[model samples]
Target: MTVSAPPAPPAAQRTPPAPAAPRRRRPIAPYLMVAPLVLVLAGVLLVPLVRLIVVSFQKYGLDQLVGGRPSEWVGLDNYGEVLAAEEFWSSLWHTVRFLVIAVGLTIGLGLLLAHLLAKVSRSVRVIMLLAMVMVWAMPPIIAMPMWRWLIDQRFGVLNYTLFHAGVLPTRSFNWFSSPVTGWTVICAIVVWGALPFVVISLHAALTAVPGELVEAARLDGAGAWRVFTAVTFPAIKPTVLIITVLSIIWDYRVFAQIWLLRDIGANKDTYYTIGIWSYVESFSNKNFGLGAAISLISVVLLGAFSIFAVRSVLRTAQAADAEADAR
Candidate 1:
């Protein structure tokens, strides 16, 4: 062009992202909003906890309670007795065993169901979700009774079906005759009740996994288990860990199922777990101090376990984060 094209004016200076709108100041409103809940928890949980520890050191039996006399401070006697008692140790053993079985089955079955849900069509998923929700919504109070009926010696559907199917030798099997069989049924119910929650939680976690990652793994010829362990599980590891911790805590404190079954004449002493032992000691045995001691011990043990669990969760999360950043 004859006259070198008029020089283009320099572009206007770009705004520097408005200084990133200044880092947001976290508002105090949220803290204030939760203050009421904190107070309520203090009143309900903290007050009872303090009372429990105080009573644990004293002989707080029904005699003292009814006689209007101050409790005798027994110091370490309750702890020594509890530690030496065979009943306490037996209860602990049963509790630990049941905890392992229930939590394991619940987590395993739940994980399987969650993956199945992911692969199912929308209608199938909806139906499965509705079924789980129904089961989950049923209170243990109601659910236990239903389960008891199913396993009842006389009119139990379980016995009828098993007898017909030749799975059981007799038409009426005494499920509660031995600790092993009784516990098997009890564990089944516990696992059943616990599965819905686990499945739902895991499904939610699974839903968050990136489709691209899954597809890439498949494209690279990873089989189902390989894909799960490599691409899918790593993504949901934090959720799984957290759920496992929760399952441990909840399963450790199981009481209602055993109590209801016992109340209906399931068995005596055979089915006693730690929670049942605590209740029996407190009310039935009228040894409140011992019960308090047991509860305090349980609280301490649980706290220790919770600490370990929290550490695991944190460690895993940190590891995952580092791996992600490395990528």
Candidate 2:
């Protein structure tokens, strides 16, 4: 006997899904959990920023510090003074130049090394990454002094080696003798320290890149440069922009490397960035108000320069992430 087959249900007669349960609202637990960190940041960052803004408007100095006198609000006089001073302008130009050279070299080298790291075997990559992390973990306070010793005029390894190798005519070469040579050394140190972080960041971005896209490019007869410019760069563009801005901010405010390398007796002015100059003015010259003003001015300048770029790149990075997740 043939069994009767059940007929399929009509399309319109089938029950629809239960409408996704209306996507329950995200829990507030995450925000609540982060409240402590927010409070800590406000205490750490906002408090000092508020104090700085207040001091920027006042004539606060050693006299006020010792005598307990109320700080007299000078109403932009400090700003005017800083704007009119040749020293501020000169120091500013020096800082700007340093920022350009240091950041450029750091990023360029970091990108090269990151690409090299990505191509290496996994074991080699892990070993090199650990070495880079060690360098990155070193504090500037310790590293700068070591670097200063390494480039010392009479006994520095650099000068000694160069002299022995006949790369130099003299047994000793003073790196701090001139601004050009001094800045070169400082930038070299800064770039060397910054390289690990930059390379790590770019390498992370490189690892996130899709292998299939790269393979497709290569299979289409695309050369290395063409593949990089077309496929590889788009994946890492956001990271590059973000790193560039951060490098600008970091290199602009470099203090230790410059301060340590400078000669205590002289040639200090020749290598002073705004940060070093600010410290000297604040403590040595005892011009607290002027130092605060200069510090504020530098912050404003850097903030203005990076604010727009930061917001734009963050959005681009987020979008890139979403696209990657979709893939």
Candidate 3:
């Protein structure tokens, strides 16, 4: 039996090892597809932004823009002039004041509207949503004139109504005579225009909140405000923070409303913000260099604010994630 075993096959006669499957090269199809969009953005946005930064340091004017002459390099002289001017400081202060008031009112009103919309019936909600969308869709140009007419000194319906209702001592109270009254009108207009978008965002965020959590809080004897603070606000805090930052940005750059309403009073210069100042410096005064410097300063300030807000939001998100994981 030991000698009966067949001799082993030779190595050369054995089956060849199976050839390795060909390795696939990494696919670059995605990059190839997105290349067109990247090119368009570089041409449209990046190029112009770089040119703007370059022009900010040069004494470029309508002549240079129209190819009449080469721009003179002024280095930081334009920035120095802008910083030295009292007008720049005044405009900056006005801008800051307007931003604080408008942003506060817009956010507070938007949150209230969102809460109301969330508690409404579907049909009512649809109607309110449509109204908000309509308001949001209106152009600033149209809104400015409409508001102006409504607050007009002689023919305004507001004065007439208030006088007839005995809320005013006179039928023709000059609303724009004082700086306080003028700014109040401007802030009101900005807040009104900005409300719809904020409301829509906040409503969507509120809808995403868990109903069961709210119900549990209520069952534990929590009131409406308490339930919102305890069970709902934590969920929507990130969204609120984002909307607030956006509102700040939008309100900070408000120009049309203030500009259009400027001619209503003799002391309208009191209402001038950075936007108006930039326009005046660039177009009216024809000091393009100083104007660009002012604009750059504004951009830098806004960028700083945005960076701070982003860091705060990231911290909040990380904290939320940690808390979630712990649970």
Q: Give per-residue CA lDDT, model 1, range 1-327, as digits (tens).
A: 587887765667544444556778899999999999999999999999999999899999998879888899999999999999998899888888998989999999999999999989999999999999998898888888788889988899999999999998998788888788888888998888888889999999999998999899999999999999999999999999999899999888888888888654556897887788888999998999999999988888889999999999999999999998998
Per-residue CA lDDT of model 2 for 215-286, tens digit only, reads: 999999999999999999989999899999888888887887777778622567877678887899889998
lDDT values of the candidates?
0.89, 0.87, 0.89
Pairing residues by index, what is the TM-score of model 2? Answer: 0.85
Model 3 pairs in collision: none
Q: Deviation in angstroms for 72 in model 2?
A: 2.6
Indicate whether candidate 1 or candidate 3 has the larger TM-score: 1
In candidate 1, which residue pairs get closer than 3 Å at backbone N, Cα or C atoms, i.e. clash?
Answer: none
TM-score of 1: 0.88
Rank all candidate structures by their lDDT, best first, as comma-separated numbers.
1, 3, 2
Could you tell me the lDDT of residue 26 within candidate 3? 83
